[model samples]
Target: MKVIKNIIFVAIVFLISIGLLVVGNGYDMYKDAISKIPLTEKVETIKEKENYTKIEEVPEIYIKAVISVEDHRFYKHNGIDIIAIGRATINDIKAMSFVEGGSTITQQLSKNIYFTQEKKITRKIAEVFMSLEIEKNYNKDEILELYLNTSYFGEGCYTVKEASRKYFGKEPKKMTDYEAIMLAGIPNAPSVYSLTKNPELAKQRQKQVINKMIEYKYLTQSEADKILEQ
Candidate 1:
């Protein structure tokens, strides 16, 4: 019984040590990752294509559009949305696969800034921790802007403005409803829903976004129907 108690005490200490290390050293490790592989470089190198501009330089409308569609409660939530996480958990359980990710925009930014593309449990935990840190340190608008500027969209575009130019040959501020929906849809599965490569799938995803917008009251049903018809 004494040996078992000793073992338990040792285990608790070990766990506490790991937690402290993660809290103190983990942030530096992740920040180094961001500085080393800045989003611009990652997009340029990975896609072997266009240069990316910083998020601050991008238009506000594009950022608003993205947040409106991708994460409606982006500004309201801290780092994670409990409702979204619960829904994702249920969906994952039903699918019996990693089919759903409940990551808020902050979480997505955390993963993008700190980790690689690998989908492992450790990476996910780090992402969650970093996301919470980001929420504590930054404002909602800042997080949203960063995500919009750094996130990858299909066809090698880095920022929303770049994507707008690549896809519609216009600035993001000038994007029409359909154009906005199309751009919003590509982030989920860039290669599969690329407008240049898979117009049909892109259209389907665009419709889905339009539906979501309507549901969220960003667009009226009539407006959604009109966009869908087009």
Candidate 2:
């Protein structure tokens, strides 16, 4: 019994050590990611003034679209999408590979901010913890805004606002129905659905977004059809 107790104590200590390391590394990674953002320049300059602010305010439509496509239960979940994680795990085990990831937007943001592009269990664990921290610290809108602004959407664009300008020559808030659908599609796989590279695929993705909007009652079938027609 003494030996068993010793073994359990050692295991607990090892787990605590691992958790601390993961969190420490995650903080470093988050700081690095924030530093690399171009908007950091704007943020710093603004900070010099009395009324400094962050420009990446979360838009209602943006949040709705993301939740509709990525994780419908985002508001309900703590930080992780258990169903997606389970599915990803099952697929990974079946294929003996790590190609699939069932990360929530928060998790993805956490991973992007604090973890390498590596597909490993250690990185994923860190991502989960960081996501939980993010959720705890920020409101949903703030978290969503940060995720949108920092996430890579291919075509060398890091922010939805930049992507909106590049793709539709408008800001996200002013995006037309077609433009919003197109922008929404980019997060799935930007290069493949990029209007410049694959116009047809981009159109298909836009249609998919419109369909989702329709199903979510954000738009009617007629509205979706009209947008598609345009």
Candidate 3:
């Protein structure tokens, strides 16, 4: 019993030391990320309603579709979703890999504008800080608009308007709910799920988006099915 206690004590101390190291390095990484924020060129179009910009005129259905699919609690949480973070943490531990992420739209925008796509613990920590900063500075609508305007949809698609024109050759407001949901699904993995690159995967992801909308009570089964069918 005494030896077991000693071993446990050593293990606890070791674990604490590792955690401290991670947090310490992570804080330094956060500072570096903050430093990069000013250097990151802002997408000016996202800041204001431009006469010719589709983002400024994006429809309610498009916003709802994105919120439903990307972050169901976009309006509920602060910068981060604790429940989603916890869920992702458990799954990552179980998988022994960083398989799940609980990034919100603001966090994704933070990466899009301020950070690179380097998958690292430090990058993830930096994203958390950047997301908080974004939430402090911008409203939910602004964040969603920026994300829609700046996010990639593969096949050289750089914005929601671009994606719409690529797929349907129409403006965003004129797109049907089915089209909106399909575009909403592309940003998850643009390479694998772009409407033109891997259309089958894109369609599958669109179904998931509609299902999420139904689960969130934004749409009924009949509504989801109707959108899916068309």
Best by lDDT: 3
Which pairs clash (backbone N, Cα, C closer than 3 Å) in model 2? none
Candidate 1 Cα errors over 4 Å, as ranges: 1-65
lDDT, ranked from best to worst: 3, 1, 2
TM of each candidate vs. truth: 0.74, 0.72, 0.89
Tell me the tens digit of each residue's lDDT in model 1 across 1-230: 99999999999999998877766565565566657775455534534434444555555434545666677788788888889888988998899887878888888887766677676545666677778877887788667766766678877676787888898898776777667777877887889898899999988887777767767777788867786676
CA lDDT, every model vs. true structure: 0.73, 0.72, 0.80
Q: What would the per-residue lDDT of candidate 3 be over residues 146-184, giving only the tens digit for each residue?
A: 788778888777677777888999988888988988888
lDDT of 1: 0.73
Query: 139, model 3: CA deviation in Å?
Result: 1.4
Query: lDDT by residue for model 2 over 89-125, one digit each (tens)?
Result: 9999999998689988888777655567787665777
Residue pairs clashing, model 3: none
